[model samples]
Target: MKKFDVIIVGAGLAGLSCGLQLSSKGKKLLLLEREGVVGGRTSSYNLDGMDVESGFHRYIGYYTHLPRVLRKAGVELSEIFMWEEKIHVRVNDEKPLVLGMAPLFGMIKTIKGLVGNRRYLSLKDKLSLLPFFMNGLKDYVMSPHKLDQHSIKEYAAKYNVTNRAFHHLIVPLSSGVFFLPPERYSAYVFFGLLAPTIPKFYKMRVGAYLGGMTEVMCQPIADQIIKNGGSVRTHSNVESLVIEEGKVKGIRLEDGQVYRAQHTVLAVTLYTAKKLLKPVFENHPWFQPMFQLPLMPAVSFQIEMTKPAVPIDVTTFAPFTCLSSFAEQSRTTFQASKGRLSIILSPPEKFLDLDPQETLQFIIKDARKIGLDLESNILDYRQVNHEYDFHSLEPGFQALRPTQRTPVEGLILAGDYTRQPYFATMEGATLSGLKAASLIK
Candidate 1:
């Protein structure tokens, strides 16, 4: 068996980031990935001569750590991403309303947008949210745990947030961002993630990548690791950890190959981690929460259009539909996607069993309701589905998140689902990897 200083499993953003940080410290590293490519949830692949991403991901301005790691990998954020200043939201039959991307930085711009769209949120509805906002900021800093017990809907009720605001604003935000309904989503996870962005709002701008994430983001980081003398092996699936005396010795691949190392980091998803670690550490206190973490499926579609469908690159939210959120990627990232649409189907539970054609019909019907008439737009469409995609930010899940420093010696954990200030986001994944790297001796 060959040995190294550290062996990191799963070359997703977390594993890749961990390797980069460790290699920078001159630690001999081995990064293994089950998939042929890296990026994990943020990965992309070529389909029908066009680049299809795993999903539509936004690089929000409030992210501080992800940018730093990207810079270290020699990838400039501005060069790969196209920034957007506003978001378009369409609620029911009401005309679409525009909101500033960074409300705190452009307070006047945000206020003007909101005020101009009086039908979306009346003066009373807007004022009704003041108490919720004030208490959320306070609780986020002082006692975030207290808010985790209640769902966003229940918490909003305590502040007497108007029904209009709840349906118009909160519903879209909860469903669009998390793919979960407001009643099931955790208030603490929602606001806690927002609190960190407050300090960086002035410098923040939401951006969409200019190309496939794997080519522009993941590959560059992997190249940096190799350049620094670290090894990144793709299609190397780990079967299990080599635990001796309650400490991780290294990992055993499915092919019966064993690689030894002083330290091992499991940077895979929550569901995958549980499958790998449960048999050995099921009764262990540190691993108990790992089994309890909730996992959800994600579904998205990429449509090809004959002509430009959406005119702008901004993210559009249309709640209470099969299509919760979408973007015109042709305008932002791919010239090939021009006149095409990338959509995220929220409350994905209902559509999980539907065939691609059936799902596309539902989306077309929903789009027509919102005045988007996509049925007549000549084109092909593709659907992407992940059975166990996201970790739930549902009420009480926040407290169940494990820390990067595990109780087991020489073993570390890293993923967005792990205990981090941010939720299941790019920033959360990147930060978790950095935290795991910091734990290494």
Candidate 2:
């Protein structure tokens, strides 16, 4: 039996962030991961000398804590990410609508860029959205929790937002970002995330990593933890929590290896955390709400094209299509991935059971509707599916999210699913980790 001051299970963003913070504070730590690599959802793998990501990931400008944590790990945001000022939304049989941000040109230019798409948004359509926007900002100041009972679609309807605007704007945002349809996603979570960026809307830019996430981001954090005299063990599958007298002692591995610690942080996925805790803390009040939290499956495709399909590196969204969002990676981040289309499939329930070839056919059909001839430019493709991808932000789910601190003395939870201002995003995960670290000692 080995002993340490703290033991963190799962080496994802949450675990890595927690480990780095605790290790830096001079606490002897041991970080364990079941997979060979560190980044859980934010990881990348090598395919025939080319790096392929688990899914399409983007960094929103509103992210504050994540960048701070990265800086502590000796990484500057600009060094690894390329920023884009425009967002593209493709409507079937029509040209892609562009939403631009002119930060240097100031707020007037930014507002014009946002509402200037007269081609898709009419005067009435734009006017109808005022109630939602006003309420979103107002709710942010008061409490977004009051709106948690309504879905995005329901909220829009309640505010009398026109269907054209709803289809063009809300549908794409809900499906593209959360992989959930507007009818299913919570309005509070959506607006809560948007409200913070309104003040900095002109400065809001989306960023893409320049290289593999594990190499440029996760590895540096892991190295920093090790450099601080902490141990990071990969391929270590924790079987169960070691509990004695209602307090966490440590964890026991699948191979029957015991590692004890004064405090233990389970920074795994929501599903994994439920599985580990249900045996012991299933009926506990703090944990009971967690059982009601839903899980979402994610499927993403990496399509290598003979030629570039998209001209720019900006993210493109096609509402009502199988695609959530996609980008030309060769132009955006990795030069080796030139002509590669990194696509995330939305409403993932439909594609979960289909084989890769069948899945590609559906995508090809949808691509044609949005003016992309994927069939003619065939090369190679890879599909990555995560069974328990994320925690679903369904209406009423906001109240279900548990806090980082639990009733158990030494047992802590850390993940994007935990209570946080942000949704299941990188910022949320980083914030959860930092909150978990603060609970210790």
In model 2, the number of clashes is: 0
- Among the numbered candidates, top lDDT falls to 2
Clashes in model 2: which pairs? Answer: none
Query: For residues 193-304, could you state the per-residue lDDT of candidate 1 as single tens digits?
Result: 6676677778656788888889889999999999999999999999999999988999999999999999999999998899889988989987877688788888888888
TM-score of each: 0.96, 0.96
Please give the lDDT score at residue 206 for candidate 1: 79
RMSD of each: 1.7, 1.7
Off by over 4 Å in 1: 47-50, 103-108
Over 1-441, each residue of candidate 2 has an lDDT whose tens digit, in order, gives 999999999888899999999999999999999988889989987766556888879998878888988999999898999987777889885788876643643455457656688989999998999998898668756876778888989989989999999998888877788888888988887888788687766558888888889889999999999999999999899999999999999999999999999999999999899989999987788788889888888888888888887777878899978888888888655676548898889878888888989999999999999988888887888888887968878887787888999889889999999988887899999999999999987
Model 1 poorest ten-residue lDDT run: 331-340
